[model samples]
Target: MKYQFFWITVLLIFSLSACKSIQEKANDQFLSGQYQYAINSYSQILENEPDNLEANQAVAESYRLSNRVEQAGPYYEKLVEEEPTFENVYRLGLSLKAQQKPAEAKAAFEKAKGYTQNETYLAETQRQIEAINLSEGIEDYFPNYELVNYTELNTAGADYAPVISENFMYFTSGRRASGIYPADGSPYTKLFRTRAEGLRVDVGNIQTLPEFQNEEGLNQAAIAISPDGNTIIYARGNSTSPKDLPETALFASYFRGAGFTQPIWLPVNEDETWWNSTPAFSPDGEELYFASNRPGGFGGIDLYKATKLANGDFGNAVNLGPNVNTPGNELFPRMTADGKFFFSSDGHPGYGKLDLFVAEKGADGNQVIKNLGENFNSPSDDFGIFFSNYPKEGFISSNREGGAGDDDIYFFEDKTPKPKIVNVLLNVFTKQRVAGEPDAVLEQARVVLYDSSNDQEGGDFSNSNGRVRFTLEPNADFTIIASKGGYFSKSIPYTTRGKTPNPEDLIQEVTNITLDTTIVLDQLILDKSIVLENIYYDLDKADIRPDAAVELDKLVQILKDNPSIKIELSSHTDDRSSDEYNQDLSQRRAQSAVDYIVSQGISADRLVAKGYGESQLIIENATTEEEHQTNRRTEFKVIEIQE
Candidate 1:
């Protein structure tokens, strides 16, 4: 028995040693930028100990560093709830943004601002929060661009940078030989061509380019053909070591009579690479545009212009100036035949690290940069746009979730969204219902408006004319409450679903129509019996009817809205039964109503049930059946007003 126990201890020690060794390996991989391998190792640990904070965080960071933010969201969500450090919270916000959850992402970023004292981090967090806000309502300005995709072309690898020319599509894909790049775990990219018709590509014929263009052990991609299709350019490079920066540069090949020439680096890069890439040619082929991270630039990667010489070489490069550059990256500069300039930027106010933007001439003739908005951009890397057909059809690339790969090519078309020119406005009036006179405008009455979700949208006090106007969204339901001192609060519903004017019927750019509603509040007089409408009871029983319960619900809302006021709910009966029997029935009916209200989350102390019996009647001697039926009614009177 002693020998067996000693063997068990020895086995336990070996198991623990193996576990520790694996954990150390995962940590090493994470530190060395082998995020994919780290992710797999940490995931194995998490399978046994799901709540391990270190393992969860390692997995989350692995996915994030690998540029798969959508995959990191669940882990970060759990980690934020478990251990909300600044990094976890900030990364969680990024994950939320990648999932297109702007509101929640903004909230997380706002919260993260409080956990850090570093000014740069705080500034970035605030900027992202403002970007989320700025992104709202921008889509309304541009025509909706619809993206279409085919299933057969997209693979588990990154496929992007599509350019169409002469009935063929040239793009880039990282699906080569299952070789992995530790930084992102994607294979080396290669340029590929396929038969195409406008926006559609024939995936079955897709094949890699000749060996000269697709050199082994290196990443080469993009064949951004010029407007004339005679010149083709692409980005080529990859890091040889993990500790070194990637050696990306722009390489071009000219289309001679029958075939292409050997590719070489553009002279503008000086043949010494420092992140120069994503080359584009102007419509007239006079100016070549490219993004570079060379020294003496406005930002990390600025768009630069170089004039094409007569000898077919690009001359000295000039930065596109601050108007088109920032402290962050600006890449994938694409120009349309009509002189419209479009690109992707991480420096602008956008939903994420990179967003598609267009530079348009303003009314003052100055350049105006505008984000393409949510319809054309996601909270992911969206770039490499090509105008296969300008303003009508084009192509873009994105790493957004739901794509078939890390990055996928998409076809976009100008759908020309319908003009939303109908303006919906509401003019609400608060009035006092006089006993014997017309409704009198109740000035200074407080009016609060709530949406269908019961969330308060806006509030105002009635003006001198007892009118309050609210801007309502199209096709929405709202509840308005009007209340004043010495008056009972009233609630009214207004819907603009079918009542709104047809947008097409409007002649001007925007047509404004005002909807009118009134909330008639009754005077809150003591001992005044305010009859509840349609309060019915079972024959000879005190049981509340379904219809009666419906009416009672309105009273419940009033009680909740005016918490300081208490009321006495009383029931009346006609002089058909004896006084004792009538009193019993009336008391039971009144008590049933009070019980019903209490069941609906109302305080019991606010309600008092009273049996009026046949003592109080609207008609002292009812000779007609209609008058007798009126005598048997339920009413509530204001008994007490508490502070």
Candidate 2:
């Protein structure tokens, strides 16, 4: 019995000493930020003592920090099952949740509540339940589209920005075959075209543009095609030519039967100085909208528009206004088939980096822009949105995981409900009375209406008589503002709500308004900036009401005398809704305004419609109705005047 006791003591001492050595090693590794190594050490200890709670928990924690949720699940489950402690179970639930097993996570959290009797843990479990509920209906947002095929084109270092037309797919690539050497003699990025055969899903017969090849340091991106696909406009960066600096000017070239014609630069008038690129053409091919970083703009890069005169010259570029251009960078403007605008932005709050967005005209002619949410966007960069109207197919490029390459092209069919039409009319009033005319008749007096809900959507002007009318979609609200060159701007508020229909229904109405001429005349004489009342909108809608029309008529008059004047119609809205909803509504509102003007005899080609949505809200917060109202509005600025 004495000998047996002596052997047992020795064995006990060796076992305890081994554990201490292992623990010390793990502590050193964990404190040094060697998480993986620490995990290995803790795992070794847990193997010796299966119920070593501390060691098991540490293993789970290290796995989580490494973003290896799948690897941590078993250990967390074991820790929680063996000891139903609040900390153990709570952490175990988190691990399950990270692995996307919300049901199992909720169950684990519920079990934990019994162990600690802590209200905080119970409350957290309820929150998790709510989040799971919200995620339940999420699958509907992802449409069912067949992945035709995934083909490895060339072993290009970085290939992206694939845009498809009738028979060709245009893209930018940094590949050795591009023949464009980088500044350091490496492969530089260049534009390439390939035949897109019957949607085979593989790039075929890739060819490079000779004119854009082998440049030392120039980078070209964001290409836009004309409606007829005869002209191409793209952004060229790092240009040595001084003329290219001031106006990120867009160049144009006709398509000869054989190939593209020599490129010619299109410069904006000297008055509007800025860096402009990423040109998007209207369906009629008479207007061009592009991104610019210019002074007097809201901030960052804003979208601007210019019209092509009968003489084949583009008029001066006009800023899209505060609604569409925010302090954030708004880029990749593309016009949809129904005349709405779409783009991408990082400034707007979204699921992640540079999600896709849409802007539309509201009944009051304002731009309302919004972000497309999680179903389409991920934590990675989601951008380069393009859609084909007839077949109703589109493509988006993303750098998210589980893609074919670093950046993969995702094809989708728009399954979300379409926008509804909501319309409003307004009567204009001015302080100065015209001789032999009623107070309403301000000849050529401009009235501007903004869809306060979605700024990127609604933007319009009045006719010869100070009267304006526009349309908007349902599920939105707006603010109205009216202004003349020598008159103060006037404002009003409105709202709309209802379940959106399959194809949104259109609503119409009218309101009468009067402007204070004293404020306008005084500010003009003093050369002080006239402060226009801010407009507002609901979560995602861009419809205008009678109140919005009053402001739109003021803008109409501004365009009449400046017959040489060309302006960009911009819309904006608040940030309370899903990005896709806001984008679609904003776009509809913008198109609604352009439609109204064309009906009133403004050349259909003269006015341009652009939507920035919530990406360009004037007010940062929407805590109050007033602040929300400030975010929704529409406005216009002169881009050019033909002498």
The TM-score of predicted model 1 comes to 0.56
Judged by lDDT, which candidate is best? 1
**Listing every candidate in turn, what is its Cα RMSD in Å to the true structure after a full C-alpha superposition?**
23.4, 27.9
Over 353-408, each residue of candidate 1 has an lDDT whose tens digit, in order, gives: 68889888899999988988887777788898887777778788988778997789
State the lDDT of candidate 2 residue by residue for 318-437, as single tens digits. 887766665556777777767677777655544434557667777888776656556676655677766644335666777666665555666666454543433333343334443365
Question: Worst ten-residue run, lDDT, model 2?
Answer: 515-524
Query: Considering summed lDDT, which 10 consecutive residues are worst modelled in model 1?
Result: 238-247
TM-scores for candidates 1 onward, in order = 0.56, 0.40
lDDT by candidate, in order shown: 0.84, 0.61
